[model samples]
Target: MIKHHPSETLLAQYCSAQLPASLSVAVSIHVDMCPVCQAKVAQLEAENAKEVFSESQLSSSTVKNSHDTEEVDFGTDLLNLITADPSIDEVYEVEPVTIQVNEHNYELPRALTRISHGRFTQVGKLARSRVAIDDGPLRSSLLHIGAGGEIPEHTHTGFEVTLLLDGEFSDEEGSYVPGDFIWQDGSHQHTPLTKNGCLCFTVVSSALHFNKGLSKLLNPIGNLIY
Candidate 1:
């Protein structure tokens, strides 16, 4: 059973394109894992689509005005922008971008560059590459992360999932060793530091929204990673 099914209202909102970017990422993951919730969301979308068609007198029902489809229309229509630029459909399922992130070779606080890291150190080495940025708009032919060594206390403006690759890190949440997966929603905050100079792999949707004060300091670095 899905432990956290987003509220029905939330699922509806997501289907209606009314959720935040980061929370939407988390909710999509939930739908991938939970078929029951997925079905419900799909049904809601179908109903909305049907409503749209019915208003145009395109209903399957031949009876006049027998349909109870609600009228829901927005003021200004948002256009679906699509370009035939041959590259538009170029979806990237690139090889997991790698990171060597060892204590000996690189200096502390260096951002990991995909081109720099050889084909050897794969991205998210510890856990299965579960969460990845597949959103079509994100520029993914190249992805980068800072080897800043220490991640400060932070709260996600969206969902943050980390998979320890070669080293370990710990915070108020718990100690995460290589292979252990950690995920945090928008509501939780924690300060994480590497205990043994670890190499970590992480995926974030939308930037982390730091709390305040100290968070201001973190915003620069944290925003860079996401």
Candidate 2:
């Protein structure tokens, strides 16, 4: 039972391919695990397709009227070519891929299986593996929290998008399970903790601002470490 989800604006941007690669990947992973989002995305895609088709039809009608003897149906030709392929309806099997973190193995989403990732960097109870994606200022990574792990209270300098991949964690707001999408900005602050360990895919646009205790001192190097 996933409780959190990407906002409607984000979903629309995802369907239009308007999001940055890292954020897009986060939304995609959420959609993979959430049936509710899946249906919404499908509907958005259908609507986009219909709009494009309508424009194409209007263009084709104009072309036919311009050249009276020449009648060309671009949509039909394209559809025929696609349907002519013997493997068009065939489904291919995808090999399962998993990543190990904190001595625990968790399977990755299908969308992430092919993306390259760097070696894990460990810091206390947290481990991070950077996903190899170039999205300007956005950085994406897989973050793992060991059992009883507690992240210091912090706020984002820009924005943070987190998709829980496995296990469970709780913050000041509430508890989050696998497939939960958490979005945070400069206005939000919280300390996250996991009792039995958890794995998450995170995309951050900037460094975090640690708010309390000794962790606050790390602000100088937060951009480099986090």
Which residue runs of candidate 2 sit more than 4 Å off their true CA positions?
55-72, 80-92
Model 2, range 1-226, lDDT digits (tens) per residue? 9999999999999999999999999999999999999999999999988987886674665234355666556677556757889887977687889888867999999988889999999989999999999999899999999999989999999999989999999999999999999999999999999999999999999999999999989999988965
TM for every model, in the order presented, reads 0.39, 0.88
Judged by whole-model lDDT over C-alpha atoms, candidate 2 comes out at 0.91
User: lDDT of each model, Cα atoms only?
Assistant: 0.51, 0.91
Error of 1 at 107 (Å): 18
- The TM-score of candidate 1 is 0.39
Give the local distance difference test score of model 1.
Answer: 0.51
Clash count for each candidate, listed in order shown: 3, 0
